[model samples]
Target: MYVPPAFKDDEVESIRATICSAGVANLVTATADGPIATPLPLFLDETEGEHGVLYGHLAKANPQWRSAPTGEALAIFMGPEAYVTPSWYATKQETGKVVPTWNYITVHAYGPVEFFQEPERLLEVVTRLTNIHEKSRAKPWAVSDAPAGFIASLLRGIIGVRIPVTRFEGKRKMSQNRPEADRIGVAAGLAACEKPQDREMASLIPIPA
Candidate 1:
């Protein structure tokens, strides 16, 4: 990612928060045949390694898991994002020099990938993942809700994945590079828009100290 100095996000805690909030990520791997990717919901085991470990599952029929990745795999997480029109900038009225831009947050995690088929590991991973997404619901479900034989059969159709994160690159582009007046205009414009993401981006616009 080409992040300018003004937009770089270096805080580890903030990065972790963004990843969790994203809920889904694009997992990419390069193989002898070509590059392939999958959109997956991953769980972060923050206690496992220096930067924490990522766990997920893929369909057994997905060839990406069976192919040997040539190098480190990448997981991309995206957060709130919205389009910024030139009309949102005060500079457009003052000097007519501003152009359209985008405001967003994202994180990239890279590490060696491991694929496993151990039933016990798969069961544990699926249980934890289910709990994470279901905890907020009024009637949360559990793996135990299914019959043991049925659950085992379901697990057999998927392969477990683990990636010990070796590094993370995070970026937050929220009009930090704009002048105070222009940024304020952007915030006000986004806040008044009907789109949920636009309103969310409005809250992230940086205020001058």
Candidate 2:
């Protein structure tokens, strides 16, 4: 990520929070057949390593798992994003100098990825992943809710992925480069947007006191 000093976000805890909050993420790997990527929901185990550990799974039939990754893999977590128009900048009236840009948060995590098909570990991964998503439902579901034989058979068709994070880089581009007046204008414009995501981004802007 090409983050300028004004846009950089080096806060480790903040970065971890962003990744955990992302509903879905892209897991990417470099392979002999170019690059392969998978979109999946992942959970973090923070106690495992200096950075942390990530857990997820993909269909056993997915070629991404079959393909051998040459080195470390990358997981991209994207957060709230909003467009900032030049018209939203107060400076546009004075010098017509403002340009459009985007404000958002992102995290790139790198680590060695290990793929496994062990029934025991896969069952654990599936159950935990199920619980994470089902926790918010009116009627939450559980891995054990399904027939034991059926669930076991289903688990056989997939593989678990563990990436022990070696490093994490985060970026929060929230209009820090803009002057105070311009930033305030942009915030006001985004705050008025109908989309919750835009309003969310607007709230992230650091307003000068």
Candidate 3:
């Protein structure tokens, strides 16, 4: 997460928004064997500690949970991103010095990792995670919808994960380093793209007053 000063995003609200909107994260840890990572759907509880707390689960068979991490774990959350062509830069025509780059929003959260197997805690985690993702559905599903025995049996195959986030490094590389005219051109170009993600990224580019 090497972020230049121009692209740094230190605002708490902005960082939190990126994390929440991401819906999923890459959890990485260093082990004696090597580094291990798992893509997980994680939730942030902003009310928890100084920074926040992250919650998720992993399959019981996954070795990542069993390995002892040498240091802090990292959770990487990625937001909208798009490829910026040098052709979109006004400087390209003036001096032909511009090069292609990627514009994206990302957050790296670091903290101690905890894995638990208690059935009660696992059930609570599963129920909350399910509700969060299902709330937008027309007829939302719930853990209670399934039989207790069935849900209990399923929970046995998974382990819970908790991380009390100690720090956050957020970056928003959205053409902020470009000149006003170049940034406008990028925004226009991306907005006209057929990809919805490119169009979404267009709105994040800063426009000069």
Find the candidate with the highest lDDT and give its number.
Answer: 3
Runs of candidate 1 with Cα error greater than 4 angstroms are none
> For model 3, how does the per-residue alpha-carbon lDDT over 98-207 read when each residue is reduced to its tens digit?
89999999999999999999999999999989999999999999999999999999999999999999999999999998999999999999999999999999999999
The sequence of per-residue lDDT tens digits that candidate 2 reaches over residues 104-162 is 99999999999999999999999988898889999998999899999999988998999
lDDT of each: 0.94, 0.91, 0.96
Clashes of 1: 0
Model 2, residue 207: distance off in Å is 0.5
Q: State each model's C-alpha RMSD to the native.
A: 1.0, 1.2, 0.8
Q: What are the runs in model 3 whose C-alpha is more than 4 Å off?
A: none
Best by TM-score: 3
Better of 2 and 3 by lDDT: 3
Considering lDDT, which of the candidate structures 1 and 2 is the better prediction for this target?
1
User: What lDDT does model 3 reach?
Assistant: 0.96
